[model samples]
Target: MSNAKSYIQTVALRDVKCYAFHGYYPEEQLTGIYFLVDVEVTFVHTGDTENLNHTVNYEVLNTILLEEMANSQKMLETVVRRILDRVLDTYSFLQTGKVGIRKLSPAMPGEVGHSFVELSYVAPK
Candidate 1:
């Protein structure tokens, strides 16, 4: 049996809406608002079989996001960073990953659409 393998996979969370209090205004916290998160992880396969142990686990990723969502903060940037840090620390299978966070209802004035931010990280080879 060959002991080498290679694969590219992306795990993503789409439109994960949550109520958070993150803004410069007091009303932002009092009223709360909606936000979305998208996460994508890429990694190479090192095992002979397709199993949970051979690749990144999406369940764990979802759980991490859910936990982070519950722990609200003042900045999505900080939140996204924390999420990326946690993912890097928790998963050893990923070679690289990117996270995109969107604020559906920004605190800006009228007619403004959704705003977003993204961060990417690659594991040291």
Candidate 2:
């Protein structure tokens, strides 16, 4: 059988609000920082909305973002990767996912408005 999917559904959590600590510097870990996390989960829409069983829950996505941020992974890349991996693993229907995390105001001396990182994952068929 071909590995092509018939229908694809994209669920996105854009700039989901969060104020958690995640950084490498001592001050960054101590003081903590606010961040904006954006996540996109794509899956095969099997037209099973009536069941809601085969679908991914929106709350799960939000929880992953909040829980991961609270862990202080020491880098945005880690957070992004974790979120993507977790989402992909949690949902068998999920095909691909992307996570984007941006620090609202970096602690650096220079005027950096936001420091951001984006990561993506695709599950094997």
Number of the top TM-score candidate:
2
Model 1 off-target regions past 4 Å?
1-5, 47-49
Question: How many clashes show up in model 1?
Answer: 0
The estimated TM-scores of all candidates read 0.85, 0.87
Cα lDDT tens digits for candidate 2, 1-125: 89856678888889887888788887788888789999998887887777657777888888887888888778788889888878877886678888999898787798898999999878786
Clashing pairs in 1: none
Model 2 reaches what TM-score against the true structure? 0.87
The residue-level lDDT of candidate 2 at 5 comes to: 60
How many clashes show up in model 2? Answer: 0
What would you estimate as the lDDT of candidate 2? 0.84
